[model samples]
Target chain A: MVESKHSWKAWLYLAPAIVLLLVFTVWPIINTVRMAFLDDYSGLEEVGGTVFNFGVGNFIKVVQYQRFLDCLKTTSILCIATVPISTILALLIAVALNSIKVLQKFLQTVFFLPYVTNSIAIGMVFAAMFNIVGSFLGTENELVVTAGVINNVIEFFGGTHVNWINVGSTYAANIFVMVVYIVWNALPFKILILLGGLQSINKQYYDAAKVDGTSKGRILRKITVPLLSPMLAYVVITGFIGGFKEYTSIIGIFGETMGPADASGRLNTMVGFIYDALASNKQGRASAAALILFGIILVVTLINLQVSKKKVHY
Target chain B: MADNNIVVMHERQMNKVKTASKVGGVAGKVLTYLFLTIMALIILFPFYWMIISSLKTLDEYRMSVPTFWPRVVMFSNYAEAFTVGKLGRLFLNTVIVGLVSTLLSLVITVISAFAFARLEFKGKNILFAGLLATMMIPGELFTITNYGTVTSLGWKNTYTVLIVPFLVSVFYIYLLRQNFLQIPNELYLAAKVDGTSDIKYLWKVMIPLALPTLISITILKMTGAWNSYIWPRLVANDGVHSLITNGLRNAFTETTGDVNYPVQMAAVALVSAPLFIVFIFLRKYIMKGVSRSGIKG
Candidate 1:
């Protein structure tokens, strides 16, 4: 190594990223890990003075918290529903647009617009849409001013006017809307990568399939999809990881009701729960909840990496 | 006659196969268009509503029949939001945070990426892999410690809290490193022979070649900083100011009994517009970074 060219300057350039990561990322992470065990928020004990210290009580308390279990379930449910559904929708759009001759770029732009928009803005809009009265497309609200619009739609469905956010059914509805927003947000990425992978497949395969009397559906399943599995794996696992880390919409959707609320509430995500605990200054509880959420996501991500490395069909 | 019949039979079979495929293909196309239209509506409706709601007047927003489309378009909602929240200053703060952090992060990551991808050193692979694993560690796990650290340093309500903590992004480095590694090793060998040191070689050789990746990563950084709700919420969502999300949230809650929907929508639209423009050109990179980075920010 010493015989190699002067590498002294490399460290000089490396110093900034390293020092900041150490000070900001690594140190805070270490401190957070330590805080997870502590019971009280008053302050932790130190060797010479009052400092944050070790306690196992918070972890024990986290396990017993009903909201923890609820959040874990909600996150899993959200991911399970969103990942596969969104991927297929995105893939279908990609393949269709890819197959077309004109309007491809225009359609792509339309589909990809939501992801670029601020989640707050998007969420605010969705909230209004979900609002019975002021919502844009929803027919349940009193507003559409068009006498028969919302009423007819509701009557058509054998239902009455109902609030999308505050109703008893808002839990599942909330997750669904959030999934819609997230999937829309995540679609362009999935579409682009999948498109890149799609284009990479040799035209020879399709030409050969035609010669062999294989149908388009057969080609899609046996060729296009299998060939695109690696990209699919990439999207799915990342979706799983990204799904649980939500914030902007949830806060905007159900403003500050994430705690001690009934079923139709956001007492379902660790991120929401952390906000809930922190709101009331229960720092210890927040730390405990944050640690649990961290552990779940990290484990899933690690599993994803390992699984994709083994099973991705690339 | 037998040979003709055989050839005709083969042609018939092929036609059958082709026709069978065509039926499903037509149905699939119809369904695909139907689904795409629905999704397109879902995707575009909220943005459309936001824009319209921003233009809606206060009375129209609160009327008996909800103004689906504002009857009398009031452009003042945005004007009011802009002035009320000191939005120009907030925009300046946001731009400063986004651009500075992005450029700083890019510069830092570019160097580290070269080191990991090309530089041969003790524990290089271990450190790089460890960094990837660290990417899985959630930011929430670190926020408490970060808060405490920021407060103790007396950096609360200061730029340090806004900028310093986020200067290094593991995900960005990972993306850049992967792009860097794709460059042929022979180029480095060539540079070495010319007496260009590794750092200089990286600057003079790898950086120029890897321009696209850096550009994409910069866009990603910009978008991430622009839409950062939580960190700003934690650090700046209080007495003096909060960025877009905070401002919107305050606006949303301020008119509690009245809940000025138009004004809040106006604020939301205003904040979202800048990055929305950037999204048009950087669409490719933005999608790639967000979807495939595997390392979430």
Candidate 2:
């Protein structure tokens, strides 16, 4: 009330953004929530057929689906593995970059290169690389393994030749591929954020610690971790949230990554599962799966918010 | 006796420090090189693969033996990708969408940021908060409604469907807002004292100051728009006005019948090549753009 002078103009100035957001973002959210409760989400076909029915049907169907539960578990496991590893690695990179003054920007560029590349094309390339006898870097592979350090590991294990995209129920195998791709994709931005957190930390704090005869390890553990908690929290919450909505790189039910046995069944990623279901042409079940996914996302997001509020050291 | 014991303890601590730093240092050096090389390979591998693979004949493609540099590099794959694929139209479609969306986001973001930053308006905080809250919501949750609304409005397969929905980004708005907020309050006050209106102050002082950030945001959005996949797939009825990404996808898939792997790879390389080149220059701005989010993660 006190700041009510000429309030009308702000609305005018803000109109375009507000209007666009409503049409694009805000309104869509409202529409999704409403549609989630309805029975007829088989996408506008049979136009007069029970459009937007307000009932418990979609939820019931979603909850009852065994695939939905499997997807939730898969997505959870994927996030659990990806988040901690990526976060830890990003922190380490940030710390190292902070220590070395030379090639700092160059290193940042290198680490982030994967993130800027076309993910879909990468998916295609990964599909090729993991295809049993796929060529390493499109070169002549005269032997079972490429002439690198990892060749020894393959030899030591008496490796059975395997198609990475074939095995349908091997969670570990699928997760391994996903982890590699996700981590590579995630490294750049994660490195960038961690670098930011490192920047915000005053060098004076480190100097004070040095003068106190404190070890570098002790200084990092005491001062650095606590201070960067907010940023780390942001990373973790958004990491899971982002993963849950993932669809771009994945080939859906028909995929180069998910080979003949439909290895996508082993994926367990929530978004992947829902997307697979949707792409399978079972629109009702896909909608049900999508709704279930939405609920899982909502619950996890709530937990993230509560935990962040409690622990983020702003 | 005390001196001897003190020396012994000091040696142990120093050794521990030396060992720890050595281990961490070696690990750091190894990781730094390892990460840089592996990431570089991973980033470069797809394009490298695309180019070499595209040069190979079908016999080379389907052969039991893996040919590294292709038996003979053929440039015809590029010509063939353009001719057989009708990839040129797809390129134009993506260009139109990318340009339109970027221009719209740039204009709207500038105006919105100005209002949020300079105006002495009521409920400014509330408006900003509402906008920020939208950021936390996963985009997919709202996608269903967007698809339905556009369908209802007869906007499907039109430029409106492709361009209108992404007119303003919350992320960009926030970026611009932060930039606008940094201008000294006196600058705006002086403009007002000189009888300048809100729009003029924005057009002259704030916009000029914010142009660097704005250009960076514009380039980023253009890349995002051009690279966009799922939304366009949903909006496009078939491949009528399909972008190159979608075009390559359909070509590779069984929908269009026989797909030449070499040609498909060529198309992919063609579609993604511009961004790959542009990123060479835009790399710095991306660091600027992503630093805010990346640092915290």
Best by DockQ: 1
Over B59-85, each residue of candidate 2 has an lDDT whose tens digit, in order, gives 676555456688878788889988776
lDDT of 1 by residue, B1-297 (tens): 999997788678667666867877688777767776787776776777778878988666655445567788888888998987668877877788787888778778988888777777666677777778777776776776777677778877766578888888787788888889999988888877788876688778889998888887888777776777777777776545466556666556532123567888788888888877777767766666655554323
DockQ of each: 0.39, 0.30
lDDT of 2 by residue, A240-277 (tens): 77677655545522253332344435454555554454
Best by TM-score: 1
Poorest 10 consecutive residues by lDDT, candidate 2 chain A: A143-152
- Per-residue error (Å), model 1, residue B20: 8.7
State the TM-score of candidate 1 restricted to chain B: 0.87
Score each candidate by Cα lDDT: 0.70, 0.67
Return the clash pairs for model 1, or none: A37-A55, A44-A51, A44-A52, A71-A268, A132-A141, A143-B66
